[model samples]
Target: MPERSLAAPKPALIEKVLMRCAGQCAVCRAWSHQTICESCLGLYARPLPRCWTCAARLPPAFVGRPRPQCGRCLQTAPPLDRAVAALDYRFPWDGLLQHFKYHQALDLRESLLERLNTALSAAEVEAPDWLLPVPLSIERLRERGYNQSHELAKALARRRGLRCKPEMLLRVRHNDRQAGLKLEDRAANVRGVFAVEPLLAARLRGTSVALLDDVMTSGSTLFELAGVLLQAGVMSVQAWVIARTPEPGDE
Candidate 1:
């Protein structure tokens, strides 16, 4: 008699093993399910109604107002035309980001990219002409061995059938990390830190582009990059981030 073929392992089993190896929070190791569990997700990742233009967490008083941008944005507008984020960067979520950015756990890129893809689909926005990941300084890239944002953008572009231009935006200077800094200092830390490749300027002209990043804290980095892209004559710029840190008043 012919030998029988072996049955393949179940997908559920594979997922369970992967989740276990990734630990509870992927970065926090706090007893989560592949970075987050359903209960913790409900408690920590609850969605806050946000301003459409600037992505600021909106209060009930501001809901249904004529303009959706927050007062700050109204006074001093951000450079990018629009922005969207999947979750608030807090608690277990922040831990996950740390793993991807600092711990070299590149495997987390897949899950983060999946979440960003969902945000894009739910927004119903048109796919941009090109996608660019916020670039890192060569020094930082050499130290980290990878740019988490670029990895995420590459995965997103491949999944969505859009072009990913990881090198379009280059980091012109190395800046200190923005974490733990006040909002006021955030902008200064990122100022003059990015530039567009001169040869890529013509391609960006008259084109709409999407900028991808692992997390957006004060949005200073995104704003700086968008400013450069706009100066390069890009028709429009939008930001796509894995998470956004809710402003103090938002809580």
Candidate 2:
């Protein structure tokens, strides 16, 4: 009898199934096995038109004015020359951000970075001379064992071929969390909390810098840090945040 040929081995059924649904999407509960499914992202994660100065959401009909600024920013300018956010700090993003910052899910860093990268591209933001993380206070750094903003800045800088300056901003003291604070009081909490690193100070002179942060609740923290950068003679300051808190009920 002719030698029988062996059939090619088949992949395990369970393996196929696992590969089919790697993880469920957090927002829509779809079996995309990704951080978020395309449908959910298409529906909820679409970027909003933002105010040029503060990065707050603006209406689609809005057109940037003589300077491409919103009413609030036009009335009282932000320290940032420009600012933008990836998401509206709502639903799935709020949860994802909490995971990135407060929880130990370090894997979320890559997902968040990917989202931020996509946003930067979609917004067509300009590259800056320096990319910097909003620094954590020493106590917070020791407790967390990682600075989310610094990690983000480094990764983003690589994508844009910019220099990541993690040491550019120093948070001198830990302030109460801004999560629940009223807008008026938030500024007071973060005021005088940031100072530029003296040795690295000279590098910022006459150079445009972009600040990276996980979230922007109020403008206080970024503003405070930008003030110091401006004092050090930074030509311009811009901010890129993963999420921006929407007005109450705007969620």
Task: Give the best candidate by TM-score.
Answer: 2
Candidate 1 lDDT over residue span 1-251, tens digit each = 99999999965456447856635654435776565555655676555556665676778776556547777887888887778888878766787788889877665666666667777786666789999998988888899988988878877887899998787888888888788688899989988889889887798999999998888877888988888888998989999888888888665
Q: Residue pairs in steric clash, candidate 2?
A: 23-33
Query: What range of 10 consecutive residues in model 2 has the weakest lDDT sum?
Result: 10-19
- Candidate 2, residues 128-235, lDDT tens digits: the string is 999999999878888888888987787778778999868778888889978778889998999888998888888789999999999997789899889888988998
TM-scores for candidates 1 onward, in order: 0.82, 0.86
| Count of backbone collisions within predicted model 2 | 1
Clashes of each: 1, 1
lDDT of 1: 0.78
Provide the overall lDDT of each model, using Cα atoms, as 2-decimal numbers: 0.78, 0.81
Candidate 2 versus the native: TM-score? 0.86
RMSD of 1: 4.9
- Candidate 1 minimal-lDDT segment of 10 residues: 20-29
TM-score of 1: 0.82
